[model samples]
Target: MISGRICIGLCFIALAMQVSSAMAEVFTYPALRSSQASDPEQSLLTSTQPMAVIYGSADIGAFVPVIEAFQQDNPFIGVEYHQLQTLEMYDITQSQRANGEPAADLIISSSMDLQMKLANDGYATSYQSSETDALPHWARWRNEAFAVTQEPAVIAYNREFFRENELEPPRTREDFIRLLVNHDELLSEKVTTYDIERSGVGFLFLARDERFFPGIWDFVRILGQAKVKLYSNTSPMLEKIASGQVVLGYNLLGSYAETFTQRNPNLGVILPDDFIVVYSRIAIIPRGARNPDLGGRFLDFMLSIKGQSVLQNEGNFNPVRADVPPSTFSSLIFDRYGERVRSFPVGPGLLVYLDQAKRQRFLRRWQDALLNRR
Candidate 1:
């Protein structure tokens, strides 16, 4: 019910990894009027029709082609999408399930840790098939959560600014730190990154950085002292950088940034060479879903070559299927960093940072370093 866009991306899963031989079942979601839902923010696109409710953090536009194809195949099954912030998606879905109410049929998010938490907590169901089994080790976990896209955390800058100002964008974190320290006066208030407090994926990137880099606190403190800009989401952050409002952006999802950069000759996307934080967008089928049978079919289709091609070409997303050729973005990423693409593996290890006490303490430290520094 929060103020957010809607993108219907859905999947259904079974208790066992084996596929249920029964045909996909259609639920009775007779079309309800939009007025029936009390919350104005929850836009029920076509109610009362059998729908596979999907909650996710991706842009509504990015999901259209995939959803349309699914609907074309399963015309009776409509899609209801609620585009929530990853944190909001987690909290609301967990709360609804805890109350024994119906929630989303599918949950897809870039906040992988949060998705893992839900899977670890038994909020999701599981399904296995040749398609699911085909996934690489790093992409599927516990038969519950599956990564659908291969992307990375990257640094993007205004290409025109770099050319005119003769600035070399950082190729490594060390180079980044040097740039910040050496050009703080000129770059002050001109650098932007995620506001971790408002962004689940942003916090995930920062938390992982802290674990991997011993001196991240010093670099983060410099960001605060330099009065770097903070934003809650990718669209605005990327737009600002492309528009020349910000000279640099950190921890951006490389796939989206690459698309933006392609459209804007003035933008650049760089995966740090010292080490790269490769990530994937994850999808899961929640337990107690209204139309889980259809959800499973949709999920299977999502992982199929046909679906992945739509993702790679139409949606402009990185498809996780190994056979999909690398987009210009991923091709450049590998050309630049080669063997150093360190994947954030899909597993319970992600749960380490989601512990409530640990998460609060981590965020407090991050806040002090990024927002409270003088």
Candidate 2:
């Protein structure tokens, strides 16, 4: 039988095949699309077709309701969204542009580092408007890439398990290390976290932790000794927790966790008090976009009060705009995180961990503890 970690990889491959097939077909048309990709199922053909922007968001489905609201006003303008994996979208944009092929009009991704790298490497267009101006300094870099959402990487747990054990939820990395150290036997195989080796966001979060926290390596060692399960994405990792296979999860997206609480009251989220990593979904108009003007209009509409509100209410997007009232969820995050919320800025700083030498060194260390333990 395959090892458990290898099984996780195979399972992730299957999951990706299911969710990313449509996106891959749209992006790689020559191989997959028939001559008659006329139907939306085949070609994403919708009525009022005009402008299209290929985006890279795992939760691209959420954009539908928000975009529909935008269409209500500009009925003539239709923004077709083509979603792809974050890294694939970035690499494809670069290759497509280099080969003189059409690329995305706008790129939005949760992998803020890849987006920032594209902008830093001169793949993004510089456009400033009231919309861009409204964003905080850290959220926008060089009038190019802009942060579109305010979300956190949080600790999610099976509420039922904690209640039954009468165990206090961890509120910091140190606290989590102690939890693992103390209950190593109970959590031996009942803990789950992102597999940084396979996941772009996971790599980013862990690398950022290494930068800010000196004790991150110790915590990783603790998790390794405890035999923590690793998953590539939030959806599947969280499913295991909901099903009681896993009792705790680390570095899960807070917004996604909030969505879980509605049906599974046993699923709970907590922002670390000592420090929490805040991630923003960054958006940028590609320098080679065919619909540059349309992209700008969409950005404006996204930042506009109405658009922002629609995103918050309809799409469940965590608002990045200061104007939007904090949802109960956001309020809780703010209340707990307080000044400990470290919003990693959207700029060259993100590119540091992407360096070839540095990444290899980081992974070497990661493997020394995590891979060896497994």
Candidate 3:
């Protein structure tokens, strides 16, 4: 008779094979129109120019290459980007729609719930990309929003500082507390992370932590004890780590970590082995877009290999395609120092409940535990 371990191994192998097969069956690349002429040169020549206006967050560095490549390919199309803060983007997009001005051609943001909000409010236009089959279900919304990049919030540390302090990165919530307690002097003020009270993305990160991990509040309390520096934005946290102003920080997005490491090779990223939350930055075209056709073309470009590669190289994001080869920095995904990265789905309903009141309540509690009480 086969042993239980043998049976489990077989089950995992079968599961992996199924997943691989499904990934293989997903959308074809370049996402050209099937109705168009079969001749590749003809299709390229006949492709419509993209005339789109994108409203996105200032934090989305991954989109730079996508925009550039799209413009280069469709020279006649004018693609303009309006960068705003998370809340500001939401307000402006809403106000623009309310004023009956032409809606933005595209919306891309790290604020997953807000993106879902736009989809639910009937503000987003739905056009399924041919590449949708390759993406995980959680990454695509009712064909309204498509996740263009997979980014995980992780711990980033300055390698030189870690070595100087004889510090090893935290592998678990408990380990994190232990390090804080023992290395108080070494860590001192050289640790930082997001202030959930002040940031929409930060609050979402906290909510996810609470949802996925039991005793997350207790974990927060440990961070309180550490007296870690907190920043309102993720960029500053990354900057601190890179400058060695802080040795380590939590809530650093994978994209930011990747970008920072390219410039500062001594920076290291660790995705915990037990539980790491992976968030996808998503894209959508608004309903009544000024240039709906251009928006569609831009969306196709984003899912293309060339566009995804820019995100991988410049913004430090994981390409959505399974066939894309992993880069040198990609090893961080499979590293042993942390928990397996788990994808977090931002359901449509999540946005309905994430109002300002609820957000404030959560942040108040978080601050009480991490800042006020500490």
What number of clashing residue pairs does each candidate have, in the order they appear? Answer: 14, 1, 6
Q: Whole-model lDDT, candidate 1?
A: 0.76
**Per-residue C-alpha lDDT of model 3 across residues 25-66, encoded as one tens digit per residue:** 111112122335589889888755434777676453545556
For TM-score, candidate 2 versus 3, the one ahead is 2
Candidate 1 residue lDDT tens string, 1-374: 21132332333422122223212122222222223456655545535556777776777656667776676667666676666667667776666676777867888888888899889889889878877887888889888999887778899998888888788999877788889889888788889888887787788888878877788888788888788899888889888988989989888887678767656878888878777777778888899887777668778878888887777676567778777776776676666676877777899998886788998998888878886555
**lDDT per residue as tens, model 2, 210-317:** 878999988888888888899877887777888789989988977677776676888888888778888888889998897888788888888777887777665556
**How does each model score on lDDT?**
0.76, 0.75, 0.69
lDDT of 3: 0.69
Q: Which residue runs does candidate 1 get wrong by more than 4 Å?
A: 1-49, 334-336, 371-374
Q: Would you list the clashing residue pairs of candidate 2? A: 40-45
User: What TM-score does each of the candidates earn?
Assistant: 0.83, 0.84, 0.79
Cα misplacement distance, residue 250 of candidate 1 (Å) = 0.7
Ten residues in sequence with the least summed lDDT for candidate 1? 21-30
